[model samples]
Target: MSGSWRAGLLAEGVSITVTAKAYRLLRAILMTATEDDKMLSRNPCWIKGADNERTPERPILTLAQVFELADRMADRRFKAMILLTTFASLRWGEVIALRRKDLDLTARTVRVREQLLELEGGEMRLCPPKSRAGKRTISIPSAIIPALADHLKRFVDEAEDSFVFLGKRGAFLRGGNFRREAKWAEALKEMGLTGLHFHDLRHTGNTLAAQSGASLADLKARMGHDSDRAALIYQHATRDADQKIADALSARVKAERKKARKKDH
Candidate 1:
């Protein structure tokens, strides 16, 4: 069945993503039938690499490009959002779910406890992180502290439970609405970053963290990955080491800003 489906999909010119998802669906259904129902002695939906989707490598912004993208946002509120997501390695769900209490500017930390999940009918619900490792305390660079402080003063409510970021109507941020209102596409295009995704900001942060000499365990803890395949060295990762990574990020930003100033002069 798997072999025929693969051949049929290829012959029909189905996209790789659709073919892989279809293969995954078939594999999952067969696995359930074999293991739970015991209707089949073995699952035959086995095709090597058929379920894997080979997506293109996402673009990573340089430190200077990150700042440029953030500055290009017409809404000042989104400036901090872009920087925080890039520097702190926050997922979209986690960033949108952030409450005033989640950030500690004095301590330079951001805590992730929950995510704002969008349901099928456009309903939004606050739920815990996808995995245990996702609920983590991340050290943020001091360079973005001023932007965050400014955003909170102007945009966020004083109540601790109030969301850190909000829509124009003082409600939870919706992804589509945010993109349209914040001029996300315009900002990207103006910065020559067409097709760059918001999630790529987190990828840039993770890459920077690694380049800062963060160990494998440090990456695991920072990224919130729990599967054995994705996790290692968590026990050895220390808060101090994470702080060093944050400091390195801050230094990089400072250096980049100085270079920009020099060029302007």
Candidate 2:
């Protein structure tokens, strides 16, 4: 009915999840609020609207799709950045904050213990990661080692741990840099894929690892999910790998049946 009511329901554990009807109702309420609906002032539902958005069970990118996305981009630095985001599941802020010293080429690991954040007062600061477990060092995949090495050599300028992605000359790369987003969206559109979000790249890494038979405990540690239940979200959310595995089993069964028929002759 109202945003307060919906928010209260959610806050009180009345609904385990958002329903399609609830989503539509929330959307409609937002529209009405924009059109001067005084009854919905300070709507808490608006704050949590993103949680209502649907997410795929498996956000894995196929090997082909990963390579295809690479081939679409000419800027090696941008390509490398996107690849790191997809492969290492580095958050955007962490990527921007990365320094040369943070990477251990010998160990092939990237420590994500810090983040560069622009505070409310508009001062940029490099601080410890948001959560305690976020202070982890994850091993970088060997597939992109060369790409990252090249990126560090060519693109990154040493300004005393300043920034890896400098937007212009002295300005730090802000999230408002629309070129990357527009380019990604256009590329996805050209490839006939829809509903790709930047954060979904992290999901891509999680799903790929899970599909490749990595244990949930390992995935949890890599992804820095604090608990088993949080890790299960990755498993429960990604069903594409399950479908592909099932298809493979069915094909094997069909092949076995064909062999049996042939042997009967």
Candidate 3:
């Protein structure tokens, strides 16, 4: 069955990561059913290290690059959105679902209560976030407060219940529509950044937080991740911070050796 699945995926040009996930899910379900049915003392669907396969790493943007992209955006309204997602570590749905009341400018915090999901037929529905942890309050940076304030004052509706972000026709913002209408491709070209997805902004924020010495618990809370595994990925993804630590250790060892040599002389 595994060989057949692999052949099918290859024929369809599906990613190996996707194949692994599909097989993992199927294996779990089959093993559980077999165990429950007393078919065997121990159900055997285990393929060593198959469940531990890693996907391709996501691209993370620098703080300067994030700001530059925001600045180059054609729509003034989306500029704040870019900053909020990268700095506040908000998912696309969480950011777009924001209402006027969800934002507390005085406190500089955004309450993530819900998310807006767009169905296949362009229908939008308000739903709870992906996980319980996703329903969190994130504090905004002082630097971005002004941008959010300006956005609210200029573009947002007056009613507290009104959506913070809306389409030109006063409808809920759809991801596809926003990408095309906002000239996302053109903006990326100008920034010389290719293959950067919108969700990568959240990854950038989580990685930056990890690099800043935020503990795993802090990262989990800030990113609204339910598992420590997700938080650990951010720490592992911070290559620059890891290199700095290595450099510091080398410098300290060199300094100690120099001091010992001087004393011996």
Worst 10 residues of 1 by lDDT: 229-238
Name the regions of candidate 2 deviating beyond 4 angstroms. Answer: 1-59, 118-125, 158-162, 178-182, 236-255, 262-265
What are the Cα lDDT values of the candidates? 0.82, 0.67, 0.82
Please say which candidate is ahead in TM-score: 2 or 3: 3
CA shift of 32, model 2, Å: 13
Pitting candidate 1 against candidate 3, the one with the higher TM-score is 3
How do the residues 132-206 of candidate 3 rate in per-residue lDDT, one tens digit apiece? 998999888889899999999999889999888887777888766677667888999988888677878887888
Model 1, 1-265: lDDT tens per residue?
7798686554333446788998999889999999999999999987889888884466778999998988888788899999998898888889999999999999999999999977867799999998999999999999899999999999888999999888888878876677877898788878877657777888788777776777777777888877644333222333555778999999999999999999999
Report the error of model 2 at residue 35, Å: 12
Report the Cα lDDT for residue 77, model 1: 82
Error of 1 at 143 (Å): 0.8
Off by over 4 Å in 3: 1-53, 243-245, 248-265
Predicted model with the maximum TM-score: 3
Q: Residue 140 error for model 1, in Å? A: 0.5
Model 1 lDDT, full chain set: 0.82
In the predicted model 3, the residue pairs found to clash are none
| Clash totals for all candidate models | 0, 4, 0
Candidate with the greatest lDDT versus the true structure: 1
